[model samples]
Target chain A: MFRYLVRRFLQMIMVFFATTFIVYALMYWTGGDPIQALAGEKPVNDVLRAQLTKEYGLDQPFLVRYWNYITDLLHGDLGNTLVGRPIKDVLADAWPITIQLAVIAIVVTILFGVTAGVIAGIRRGSIFDNTTLVLTLIVIGIPSVVLAPLAQYLFTIQWKIFPTTAGGDASLWDLLLPGIVLGSLSVATAMRLTRASVSENLRADFVRTARSKGMPGRRVIGIHVLRNSLIPIVTFLGVELGSLMAGAIVTEGVFNIPGVGYQLSKALTTEDTPLIIGIVSVLVVIFLVANLIVDLLYAVLDPRIRYE
Target chain B: MTDIHVSSPPTVGGGRHLLEVKDLFVEFHTRDGVARVINGVSYHLDPGETLAVLGESGSGKSVTAQAIMGILDMPPAKIPSGQILYKGENLLAMPEEKRRQVRGKEISMIFQDALSALNPVFPVGWQISETLRTRAGMSKKDALNRAVELMDLVKIPAARARIRDYPHQFSGGMRQRVMIAMALAMDPKVLIADEPTTALDVTVQAQIMDLLGDLRRDLNMGLILITHDLGVVADVADRIAVMYAGRIVEHADVRNVYKHPAHPYTEGLLDSIPRLDSKGTELATIKGLPPNLMRPPTGCAFHPRCKYAKAVCTTETPLSLDLGHGRTSACHFAKEMLDGTLR
Candidate 1:
């Protein structure tokens, strides 16, 4: 199992090298007049342009520059930002806020979404199931960008329950409003998936066997039903985590949370290649790691899966 | 096969029989209307006896078992009238919660597909110990111990080691054995095996049947073997109830049902069984599908498929006439057939 995981890690490194190479080739080298874009019409002569190109290794072929980039990344050198700050420093400052917000939303969605799903599945056609079905539909029907502001309007502005925009404080509640708003749609989708999965699992012969063996409804749900139902929920969680990371662009801007999305947005308008590349690399790693966790969890949630 | 090893089944069977279904009718309300799937079906079982509810598909065999377990798919399913008397108590009339209590404790059911029946995520032991912890209220340690014992009882090798294995780790037959062991854990009064071996290969099927027969004798528990295969039930059932289109067309000793079938539908079913003797001959078929219960024939439902169907067969539904010794058959010429007058 360890050997298989190590092999997979090696493969992931290969993927990382390939992606970084492509991103560099597509964004900077292949594009028109990168020197002028880099200098921003500062009116330098040929000598200064040549010096700048040599220093940044822009004169090298795309593949050669990519190799250097790969080697530097391996040694934890993410390169200096366009404005002279270290790219690593920019990423370090913003990664936490994103983690905090994503983790909070994920945990909340799992707790409520799965619980609601199990309840709805057991009672199948009851009013609770119907209500959850309606609520889930509505949640998935509208986009989070729309839902987030409306939730802020109704709950924050009108109800005075939560602050309208995120403040500088890193207290838990400072993140709650946007977290709930960001997670509400996922919560609805996750709950629907859980309910559908649980309901299907409950109708399985083993559930009847468990029930016939005198196991209670809850036992059937927890052990026999919900256990099988978790696969789809795990998948949805992974996707939602990724989207919320990128999607925090809107949420962070709205809530004034200076996370990765906020940084990426700022870098995009200024065409800061180093900062953009830095944030994108961090995001790719996060996405890959999240998927790895989910895949590993598959074996944990289902012991039938062998790692090798 | 001869050993009468007794099991102290925890079910309270009292002095009378363990279970008896009296005139049970299970109806399903579909888009068309309410259609009676099990109409006035009746059967009883003594301790340690295996009674096979034998028939073709759509013959109300499974529906009857599901109704007894009180887990029939609802909205469509309605009991209408019947008494599922488990140890002198009417289970059908009882409260659902009480019925639930009785299901796992006294009347456990093993489903057809063992692989799909168990939870894929949990360990086999966790799934097996479920009845022990949930119904018997055993401690986790006790439940775990019992689960291992139950696995061993089903002859699952390396019980302690393999308890942690998932459902996918076991083969189809092994999973079926696990299902059997789990069902037997609670020491039920009656084991309703709903087509237990249909999903397995012929050899595995025989092994599972043998295991079930051995368990029945050892536990001395009543067994309701529900299957559509006559060949599968021949070696196990003491008596057979041959059902057709939602009613029992013939009920007698296994020997009697095979040797002297009174109902034409029963004879057709027997004829439909491919004969090794009649090699190279076209296999006899029932000629038509079982009548759609949503809109059945006005008179005898089997008249369309029955070779011996008469003019009276198409005019009125036949009555269940008593043959003898609790044996009854629903056929117009049941008495004539018994007397050999029909010939």
Candidate 2:
């Protein structure tokens, strides 16, 4: 098992580098003139432009610039934004909000989504099952872009039940609505995946064995059926956690919550290359790490799966 | 339902057998139609006796076992009418809670395909110990120790070490041993083994049958061995019930059935078994497939496939005729068949 983890760790590192490079390359190839954006519509003097370009290493070739970025990354320097704010400080200010949002979103997904899924699966073809099926399809169909603002309008503005926007001092309470909106799609996916898995495992031969053992119906479903069903659900949640940590731009925008996605969007408008790369690099690592954890969790849930 | 089949002479006090399935009728409500699976099936088992239920695929042998275990999914698979009696009490009429108490504790079951029957996630020891922990209220350590003992009882090699392994880690025969150990955990009065050796190789099949037979004799438990293998049934089973299309075509002592099958279906099954004495000849096979349950043929369900099917056979269902010496055959010409005068 230790050897397997070590191999997985090495693979994670390789994937991390490969992912960060691709993100960097994509940004570099598609980016507009960052120097011009910094100059703010004024025609820059040749000398000033040259000095600014040399300072930021914009004059260097793509490979040289990429190498320098990697070197600085190894030395614990994330460089600075176009406005000279340390990218590290910017991330430090933004990541906690996104992490809190993602954690709450995942908890909500598990508590509500998995419960509904298990019920729907066990009582298949019931009214609850039909309702869940339609509701999940509806939620999955509506993109977050439309759902976020509409939810904000319905719950915050019209109903006046939730806060309209997150204040500067955003408590977890203020972020709750946005969290649900951010997790809505994943909630649908988790519910459907869990429902399918639970229903499938419900008829499995082991379940009959468990029942034959005089196990209570509750434990048969809770332990035997649910344990086997959790493998796929956990895999989906692990990958979802990484994306959730990256934050939902629409959800953050609608709620006016300052988070990683909000900062990333602002950087996009200003062509803040360093900030973009810094945030994306962290996200790449998170995604790889989450995948590694899921793989490890797979072995825990299913003894039949062995890794050498 | 046959009166003679259900009215077996009681024990000294007029009490029932250890386990009795009386006139059970099971039907499956499917998209196509209601598929009649078990039609007035009746049998009884006594302590320390092994009753082998012999049938081809789709003959409702496994379904009958599942119905007794209370594991058949309702709605899709429903028991229209039946009495599964344990100690003279109707299990079908019992409350779910009381019935559950009987399951695993009083009447446990082992299934075919041991690898699939055992939970894939738990260790084999834990699976065996689970009933002990839950029903008997044994401590974790005590349950585990007893699990090792049970494994040893079933003749699993290195029981102490192999107990911690999962079901998939064991060979097919070894896995079946693990299943047997689990079923025997609570010292159940009635142990239903549904095709216990069907998934095993030929040599392993004999070994498993032997282990089961020995265990039944040692524990003084009633063993219901469900299988299609007549060869496996010959030695281990005291009595055998041969099923055809969801009904018992013949019920008799194993020796009697082997010597002179009263039902043509049982005769065909015996003939189909490959024998060294009949080498290089085309193996005898029963003609036609088992009838589709959703739309069973008229009269005797096996008439379409019976070699001696006649005009009356296609028009009238045979009664379960009581032959002398504790044998019953549901055939119009059962007497002639037993006397070797059918031809």
What would the per-residue lDDT of candidate 1 be over residues B230-316, giving only the tens digit for each residue?
A: 888888999888888888888888998888888877777778788789999999877888888887887788888877678998999
- Report the TM-score of chain B alone for all candidates: 0.93, 0.95
TM-score of chain B of 1: 0.93
Which prediction has the highest DockQ against the true structure? Answer: 2
Error of 2 at A109 (Å): 0.5
Instruction: Kindly list the interface RMSD, in angstroms, of each predicted candidate in the order they appear.
Output: 1.5, 0.8
Candidate 1 CAPRI grade: medium
How high is the DockQ of candidate 2? Answer: 0.88
Per-residue CA lDDT of model 1 for A1-308, tens digit only, reads: 89879987997887776777677767765455556766776876999889888988888887787778778887999988777899998777787788888888888798888789878977888999999899888888988678777887898889999877775556678889888877777788788888888888877877777767766676667766776787778877887887677538877777888888888988776777777777777677777777787788777766677798
Off by over 4 Å in 1: A29-51, A123-135, A148-160, A167-169, B1-16, B339-343
Candidate 1 Cα deviation (angstroms), residue B323: 1.6
Total clashing pairs in model 1: 3
Model 2, runs deviating above 4 Å:
B1-15
